[model samples]
Target chain A: MSPIATAALAKTAPPAPPRRRARSGPPTRRLMAPATLFLLAWMIVPLAMTLYYSVRHYNLMMPELRNFVGATNYKLLLTDPTFWHSLVNTLVLVMACLAITVALGLGLALLFNRTFPGRGVARTLAISPFFVMPVVTGLIWKNMLFHPVYGLLAWLARELGLAPFDWLAQQPMLSIVIMIAWEWTPFALLILLTGLQSLPEDQIEAARLDGAGRWQEFRHIVVPHLGQVLYVVVMLESIFFLTSFAEIYATTSGGPGTATTNLPYYIYQNAFFQYDIGLSSAAAVGAVVLANVFSFFLIRFVAGNLNAGSAR
Target chain B: MAIVELKNVVKNYGGRKAQGPNAVDDFNLTTRDGEFVVLVGPSGCGKTTTMRMIAGLEDLSAGSIRIGGRDVSDVAPRDRDIAMVFQSYALYPHMTVFGNMAFALRLKKLPQAEIEKRVREAARMLDIEHLLERKPRALSGGQRQRVALGRAIVRQPQVFLMDEPLSNLDAKLRVETRAQIIKLHRSLGVTTFYVTHDQVEAMTMGQRIVVMLDGNVQQIATPHELYAQPVNTFVAGFIGTPSMNFLPATVGDDARSLQGEGYRFRAGDARAAGLAGKAGATVLVGVRPEHLKWCGSGDAQAANHLAGKVDVVEPLGSTTMVQVDVGGQRITAQLDSAIAVEMGQPIALTCAADVLHLFDAQTGQALGLPAQA
Candidate 1:
């Protein structure tokens, strides 16, 4: 039964007996225990390990030097120029990809909203990009589209009488941005298409009869209705973008003098390449703080909206 | 205010098949200036499609629509000079009541002061003035609907199209909103075309109600005319609650009476006129539940009576509705609540001659009914 029908039935139904209520109370808490404990161990253990490693002078290269460093690793990593550069790169990658994907996704979603021949097949094909593995996406773009000599783009450039360009070498950051955006745009499109579909047709009809042209209807009715869905999309995309790594690893590999190295790549470099556990742990902690700060504002905005929702 | 005319308007969703069955087939009507017209039918009966065509929301498959004598077949919906209220109360969720009401005027580039004055006036009329600053998400369903109404009222468009605006409300609130819309129509006097699947709303609100079935108009008449003289069995059945009952009968040899299973009745002169030469023809006898009263023996209207066993009795405060099984057919009778009835009790039902309706069995079209009576 639908929730509204269930609610109405509850309203008209007699209240439950005291014995039935008492019987339901204990099992509810018991049923909730597994998920509660799982979430706590899942989130808290890794957080505890990161905090533990950040305070110690642990370096995998020389295990004998393990001792309490007491903020030294944090201070050194915070002052590093490469750390600042990676931070800037991370922000650029996230912001650029977000802008590209959202803009393109919104346009595609609007286009797909209308009835056209082959819409189901077209939508399925359009959404396929989101399902491709990130490493595969990187490899495909690198070898098939961006390579200077054998790539499709190179062939097109030569056909147009232009020089073949080395995309990953000369424009590593842009290449990574494009690769990541190509994969993630479908995520935005799917979410935004669902939102567009959920928009009531009556609203659009009402707007038209209210003298709204196509553009005005889109701006007033469509945009406002899609606001919450857009917020969810941005929040999820930004989080995923902040932790983006596979594309850069498979293609640029943080090369060209740290041009495409984001915070995750920086942590990987310190932990796996330099074998400096404490510093990488400190960097990982910083990334966590950044993610928390982003979520804090977004959750506040969403909660504020919820609290203002229709109620007596 | 303008006269809205739909000339042979038709709608069909079938692409590339011009000969396909229409959703709204060749509907035609012309409204007097400032008239409140309602299109009512069962779902998929083309009432909503007809209204949408007038609003220019749906393209006419053929024919043209005119507003005050100007053809609007090629005009866009935005340029058609109309406003609509939707069943879902489609208020812009992000906008305050004030903003929603002011939207159309602002789109027209009306001065800010004029927009404010018109919005405030409409809000006052809808009793939503105090909710001007609240977003639609912050309002109750009824409040949101008022804002939707206010949104249309502020536009003061040449025509008002409403598609089941009260369907989303609770029953009590729907009735209240129905009265409010009627009052709004009386005051503003815009040429209005309202669509609903509800016969009650159509009867209560429309100056003239258009009954439609299977994309074709069944009849166009006032509530009184529709209730008293439905042109077909469909209209007669659709317009009443509990609906008009149908029983197969044959004209008596004398042609002034009807003979059905287990019963016989005189088909009064006016009702028998069309059966003059069709002595043995099968016909359908129609009578509304209210018109069939539970009568004891020796009642004054003894000329027409059906004897049956009461199968069920529903005693509402004002009246008792009893379903009776007569022979193999069931008939409903509405009687005074003071009259007691019992299940399985043999009962007699009497209907006055003027209230009896006769219809051709095959065509389901009313017969022996004067057109203007």
Candidate 2:
């Protein structure tokens, strides 16, 4: 069977291994013991500490008055207006970048699919943005391009006889979205292009023989063939985008008036600036819950695709 | 319905460097309307290139092609009104049988009713009506083969090109589907340009076979003509089952006798007259396995007999193959199973002079073939 079919088939199958067979061999648990113990300590310790802090009135500024809070910190973080604003910002940033990168990534991948004089060099250059460090990418966009006084965009605007527009001040969320897309579109392009290249060449010949023109071939064959990779790109990007922090920190610093503060940056402000450790830990736990909810939908969506793949 | 005319069609890779190798060099063929023409050759013999040129998939380096009396040299594949069945089938994996067969008609902007009518008719003809709702991945290999054939049939194109379409099937299915294809060809009566390297398919399926080797056509003739009177040693060695055996011999001054290392045979005047000009030169005597007969050992020294010891016997119930070792060379001969020839037994073989083929040894060109009628 093909690897795709095997993976898809494995999804529909029950998780439990045959008990008789597993018991017939040396215990499989013995091999898993060391890794399992290490992971337990690694993940469970931080989680237990966070849970401990979330339920108490712990404040580094006034440690003498710390006591059992009993959901007080949860109520405080949930009722705060800044928390709601940051939540919206996170969702908007992730959705905008997701839509832009996937659409443009597919277009760029199709562009690179054709043969050219410098195709190899061009492809290497295209993917170079994805490997840049987040801090460097953030600084480069903020200082060299989005800077209103002497940035590249300002120089170009001056040449066009237009007023120099302030990017970060006027549209902070849009600037962050563009920077993230620039760094991530290459990832989408790499995968979608591989999918396009892997399609059998003969099918295109057959389509031509059947009287299909270029547009019809791409619409009917190319689009549907890229379906799985598109889903995967969206899922993985969503998970990473939900926790976006470094780009916001390095560029906007949570902004002129909290215009670009996302969930992670919001939590950082509460903990270090306000010395509200209990509230920050509660917000961190909320972030984990939100990630779990997104994860549930993503796995269900992928399983649906896999199940349909096996049906074929 | 169409005649495909390829006039000196040439295909060169990276521009011909005065004498660089052509993938296809100066290929020419004209198929009569409704005729079945198959190009057969070993791999890299440019058979597939000739078919692709007819379909307008591969551009010609020079010369021109005319399909149905219209010059199609500069036309796109879709504009040429041709349909191709690829060796890989190339059926759309996501489409059902009806969808695949109906795709071409839809492309031409045909009415939905007419497209349905054509798709159903082709599916019925190919006995794939029940599979109309099934996608390619759900069908068996044989079903997929029929769907590919049905896809081409539904197009009703000016010409049909098949690039070894049946090669993916098992042996049993290959044989059964061949008969079905012949029936479809007659019922449809569309001109077809088929390509394959299998001689058996060439003999059974093609009205005329174009034997090619090394980007050049070796011979183009009917199956019987290719079998009985091959123009050269390559066709002789390539065409028949248990292919024709060749023995190196020098012609005698009288032009009627040949002497080899351990075999001697006589060629009568009717066959030898063609070789009279090369009387003193060396030549090859070719004989088909079925033409060699067993003779008693006492008569082994007769003018027409060659004596050797049997090296292996393969009995096939009704007939047996006997491989004989003569001097240091091996010759295979077919005999009736009742003859009961044993391995390691000495055998005498003889044949009538009419069955022998004489060829110029150095050139490998036939010496005694009657002129083409």
Top candidate by DockQ: 1
Please identify model 1 stretches exceeding 4 Å from their true place: A1-24, A27-33, A293-312, B293-296, B299-302, B338-341, B371-373
> In terms of lDDT, which candidate is strongest?
1
Q: What would the per-residue lDDT of candidate 1 be over residues B304-352, giving only the tens digit for each residue?
A: 8888899999998899989999887998888899888999998888888
TM-score for all models, in order of appearance: 0.90, 0.90
Candidate 2 per-residue C-alpha lDDT over B1-373 given as tens digits, one digit per residue, 9 for 90 to 100: 7988989988887644535788788888888999999999999999999888888888888889999899999999989999899998999877778888888898899999999999999999999999999889999998999999999999998888999988999999999999999899999999998999999999999998999998889999989989988999999999988989899887888878898877888886557876786777788999988888888777766777778899999998888999999877899999878898999988889988788988889889998677777
Model 1 lDDT tens row, A227-308:
7888888899999999999998999889888999999999999999999999999999999998888678867876576445
Chain B alone, TM-score of each model? 0.97, 0.97
Query: Can you write out model 2's per-residue Cα lDDT over A1-312, one digit (the tens) per residue?
Result: 999999999999889877778566877899999999999899988898888999999889998978998899999988999999998998898889989999999999999999988999999999999999888999999999999987999999999999998899999999999999999999999989999998888888899889999998886667667777878898889888988888888999889689999899998999999999999999989888878887787678866775464333
Grade the docking of candidate 1. Answer: acceptable
Which residue ranges in model 2 land beyond 4 Å of their true spot? A1-29, A32-56, A62-74, A292-312, B15-19, B268-270, B298-303
